[model samples]
Target chain A: AQTIHQWPVAEIKAVGSPLSLGCTIKGKSSPNLYWYWQATGGTLQQLFYSITVGQVESVVQLNLSASRPKDDQFILSTEKLLLSHSGFYLCAWSPTGVEQYFGPGTRLTVL
Target chain B: QQQVRQSPQSLTVWEGETAILNCSYEDSTFNYFPWYQQFPGEGPALLISIRSVSDKKEDGRFTIFFNKREKKLSLHITDSQPGDSATYFCAASAGGTNTGKLTFGDGTVLTVKP
Candidate 1:
């Protein structure tokens, strides 16, 4: 079975602070990776997706960027945090042309 | 504009009853529909899904009814239990793109009383 892990389960940061969240998938090789964000009582928004290592596509511009430095690892980062950036960030992986499997997710609060 | 929409922002039902959730989308290119269940502080999990080619899909107590002409789909939870209480999200995707990226609705919170 495959398992996905996300780091820093939760975080509280002040505005203008830098932030970085990581996700790693085990037992799956060459899988597609995606990043999604959901605000409190809001719909889930797709941020970025990557089909292969070192290449990522932006689905929506939230002033955040994603990198897939390794086959099993995906990283979401930002240089400055805004109040609107506070939300639950989810990392997902999927085989080509199938539904995605989401990670535990990271809760971020920007003050 | 929001491409996907779900009705009854919240729902409550007694155990053993049936719970129905409605969803609709605007994009004709969306050929795949999925319903996800999420507990507090957890990621949404795929509960059931239906392709545009099919009108319905079922998994045990969960069933999805799709109306391709209306661009609408619904999830039916039969014999609802307390464990079924959670926020359910309706999502749509364009399978032809093969991106595996889904567009999600605002979600419906279901509460099943024992």
Candidate 2:
């Protein structure tokens, strides 16, 4: 079985503050990891994806960065948060990069 | 641009009734379609999916009817129940050849009355 875990299930931060969200995958080796953002009740937007360690690709410009430091971990971070960065952050993993399994998710609120 | 679109921003159905959710894509390059079901405060789950090569895909009570020519698809939930109430998102991707970057629709909220 595969398990995806995200840290700090929810966060409330002020604008311009730095933010970091982490995701870890267990029981699956070398799985593709992806980060997505969604507004409250809105469609999901793909932010970034990592096919291998030390290699990350950005799909859309969301003022955020992602890193795959280890085969089992993917991290999303931002130097400075904007008001528009508030929303739900989701981490997903896929073996074939087509059928994906999503994590529980992290809710972010920027004031 | 919103490449993927869903119809009937909201829908309501009774128990044992059938609920139909519609979706369409504007991009011709999109060849993969997947439907996701999301509950409040949770990540969306892959409900069912259909490739452009196939017109229909069924899994138990959930079925996907696709029309490649029309660039449209519909999700039919038969024997609907209150537990089936949630937001369904229609998503599209280019193909399996590239990284899976899915374009999502706004989503349709389905309410099932017991």
Candidate 3:
């Protein structure tokens, strides 16, 4: 069985602060990784996706970037945070294009 | 523009009643559709999915009805239970793209009364 883990279950930061979130997948090698953001009462938006290590594609620009430094690791970070950056961030992995399994997710609050 | 849309921002039903949730997409290239269920503070979980090749897909009490011509799909939950209450999101993806990025709807909150 495959399991996904996300770090820093929750975070509260002030505007202009830097932020970083991490995700890891166990029991699956070379799985596709994705980052998603959802605002309160809003739709889930795809932010970035990675097919292989050291390469990531931006689906939407929100001043955030992602990198897959390892086969089982994905990191999402920002140099500067804005009030609008607060939301629920999700990490998902899929072996194929058919279905995706999401991690526990991280709740972010920007003040 | 939103590529995917879901109707009835919220729904309420009594236990054992049938609950219907409607979803539509604008991209004809979208061949795979999946419905996700999310509780108050958890990540969305895949509930059921249907491919354009089929008109309907069922898993136990959950069923997905797909209308390719109308570009519409719906999720039907039978014998609803209070534990079924949650926010349901409809998502679509163009398969074989490698990216597998999904476009999601605003979601419909379902409240099943016991």
Candidate 4:
């Protein structure tokens, strides 16, 4: 069985502060990883996706970035947070097609 | 392009009743359609999926009906229960030769009463 893990379940930061959300996938290798953001009571939006190590694609320009430092590790970060950045951030991993496994997610609140 | 769209932004139904949720897509390339259920404070989970080649797929009380020609699909939940209350998102992906990148709909919040 494969499992995905995310950290800090919840975080509250002030505007202009930096943000970092981590994700780790167990039991899968070279899986496609994705970052999604959902505003309060809104639909999920694709932020970034990575197919392999050292390569990440930005689907939306929300002042956020992602990196696949390792095959099973994905990180979402921002140098300075904006008030609009507050939302639920989800990390997902897909082996190939259709089905995907998602982590618990990090709830960020930029005050 | 907001490839996928779901109807009834929110719905309320009584227990033991049936709840019908609708979805439509604009991308003709989409061959795989999946419905995801998300509970409060939790990540969305794959509920059921149907391939474009198939007209219907069923799992327990949940059923998915696909119409490739009309570019429409729907999820029907029979005997709705309070536990079945969650937001449902419809997603589509071009299955073959594609990376399984899903384009999701806005979602419909279903609330079931007792």
**The best candidate in terms of DockQ:** 3
Q: Please, what are the lDDT tens digits per residue for candidate 4 over residues A1-111?
A: 889999879999999999889999999888989999988788888888888899898989999989999999999999999999999999988888456667888999999
Q: Is the docking of candidate 4 incorrect, acceptable, medium or high quality?
A: medium
lDDT of 3 by residue, B1-114 (tens): 789999999999999999999999999999999999999889999999999999999999999999999999999999999999999999999997889989999999999999
The CAPRI category of model 3 is high
Which tens-of-lDDT digit does each residue in B1-114 have in candidate 1? 889999999999999999999999999999989899999999989899999999999999999999999999999999999999999999999996657779899999999999
TM-score of chain A of each: 0.97, 0.99, 0.98, 0.96
lDDT of 2 by residue, B73-94 (tens): 9999999999999999999998
Give the Cα error of residue A15 in candidate 3, in Å: 0.8
What local distance difference test score does each model get? 0.93, 0.94, 0.95, 0.91
Please say which candidate is ahead in lDDT: 2 or 4: 2
> After best superposition, candidate 2 residue B85: deviation in angstroms?
0.5
Residue A103's lDDT within candidate 3 is 93
lDDT of 1 at A80: 97
Error of 3 at A28 (Å): 0.3
* Predicted complexes: DockQ each: 0.73, 0.75, 0.85, 0.60
Ordered by DockQ, highest first, the candidates read: 3, 2, 1, 4
**In model 3, what lDDT does residue A99 have?**
94
Model 1 lDDT per residue over A1-111, tens place: 999999989999999999999999999999999999999777789899999999899999998999999999999999999999999999999977568888999999999
Cα RMSD of all models vs. native, in order, equals 0.9, 0.9, 0.6, 1.2
Supply candidate 2's per-residue lDDT for A6: 95
